[model samples]
Structure formats: C-alpha cells, structure tokens
Target: MLFELIKLGVDAFSSWNSNRSEIKKIKLENKKELVQLDHELKVAKAQSQIRMAEQDQAQTYNLDMQTTIDMAKTYKDEFILIIFYIPMIMAFIGYQDEVLKAFKSLDLMPDWYILIIVLLAVSISGMRGLFKQALELIGSKFNLKGK
Candidate 1:
C-alpha cells in the first residue's frame, strides 16, 4: 500500500511539472505574438505619417510655385508693355517707315510662330477672358484664369 501511494504521488508531481512547462511555453508564444503585433502597429503608424508628410510637402510645393508665378506676373506684364510701347515711341519720333517695315517682316515668320507669338501676347496682357469669350471651343480646353 505504501508503494502504491508513493507511485501515485510521483505521478501527480510529474503531471504538475509537465503542466507548468506547457504554461510557460504558451506564455512565451503569446508574448512573442503580442510583440510582433505591437511592431506592426508602429510600422503602420509610421507609414501613415510618412504619407501625410509627403502630401503636405506636395501641397507646400504647389503653393510656393503659385506664389512665385503670381509675383512674376507684374514684371512679365510690364516687360511686355514696354516692348509694345517701343514701336509706338519710335513711330512718334519719325521712324514710322522702319516700324512698318519691321511689322511687315514679321509676316515672313511661319504661321505657327505667329500664332504662338499672338497667344503669348494675349496671355501676357491678361486678355484671356476676352479671348476665351471670343473662341468658345479653344476656351473650353484653355485653363487660363485672368485676374
């Protein structure tokens, strides 16, 4: 009877040890999984932040570009006005024939070149609205907003 009791006690101790070891293993696996999940969450958050930052940078760049264009608009207008005024000033000073000849010489240019020059002049003079109204088909595709 004593030997049987000893065997029973031994079996119980063995079972307890085995259960403890299994519990420890399960706890370790759970901890590893929790750590991996935490890492993934952090990485996802970081990637989201990066995307937001990129969008912010793009917006800033676009604003800066627009500001630069706005700042140059006045200078561009003045420069083009001065160019147009030169011929008139010369004509007033008795250079009408030369001015006429120069204008006639422009006719020698290709039609495409003349068209481009005309468009440039109209655009620079801020006459886009009038041009758009006059040419509905072209205006539909042209995105020039005159101020």
Candidate 2:
C-alpha cells in the first residue's frame, strides 16, 4: 500500500510540473507578443506625428505664397493706375494744342467747335470705364479673382 501511495504522489507531482512549465511558456510568449504590439503602436504614433508636421509645413508654405501673390497684385494695381493716367494726360495736352491752333486760325471760334473739343476731351477720359468693364468680363470668365 505504501509503495502505491508513493507512485501516485510522483505521478501527481510530474503532472503539476508539466502544467507549470506549459503555463510559463505560454506567459513568455504572451509577453513577447505584447512587447511587439507596443513597438508597433509607438511606430504608428511617430508616423502620425511626422505626417501632421509635414501638413503644417505645407500649409505655412501656401500661406506665404498667398501673401506674395497679394503683394504682387497690389503692385500691379498701382502700375495699372499709373498706366491709365498717362493716356488721359496725353489727351489733355493734345486738346490744349488743338485749342491753341483753332484760336490762331480764326478771329472768333464758333461755339460748336468749342463744344466738340470739350466733348472729345470728356470722351477720352471716360473711355477708361469701357476698358474696366471689358477687363471685368475677362476676369470673370477666367476665374481670376486673384485670391
């Protein structure tokens, strides 16, 4: 009877040891898998941060380009205003010369001729409105809102 009890105890001890070893192996494997998952999570977070930084840089660059474009538009508008005034000034000078010539050619200038000269002067100045409207039409067609 004592020998039988001893054998039974040995069998129980071997079973327990085997189960413990299996549990330890399973725990080690689970820990390794958890470590790998943590590494992957860290890598994904770093990649997300890099993408966000790149997006921010691109937005800043776009803002700078927009500002440059706005400044250039301002300069272009000033240049156009200068160009628009030049023709008006020349027309005024030419009308003065015509008036002087008319006065030299006649003892008394007729009212009709004086009225025609004044109308011509006014027409020359007002032609800028036609040019502005044409430009507006072209701008709208091309979607050139400039901003």
lDDT to native, each model: 0.80, 0.70
lDDT of 1 by residue, 1-147 (tens): 999999999999999999999999999999999999999999999999999988966765665556457746468767878888999999999999999999899878899998898788876555655554567655555844441
The all-Cα superposition gives candidate 1 an RMSD in Å to the true structure of 12.8
lDDT for residue 60 in candidate 2, whole number 0-100: 53
Model 1 CA deviation exceeding 4 Å by range: 71-147
Candidate 2 least-lDDT 10 residues: 121-130
lDDT of candidate model 2 versus the reference:
0.70
Best by TM-score: 2
Per residue, candidate 2 scores C-alpha lDDT tens digits across 1-147 of: 999999999999999999999999999999999999999999999999999988966765665556556656456445546655765576587776655565577537787986676544433343434444566799999999684
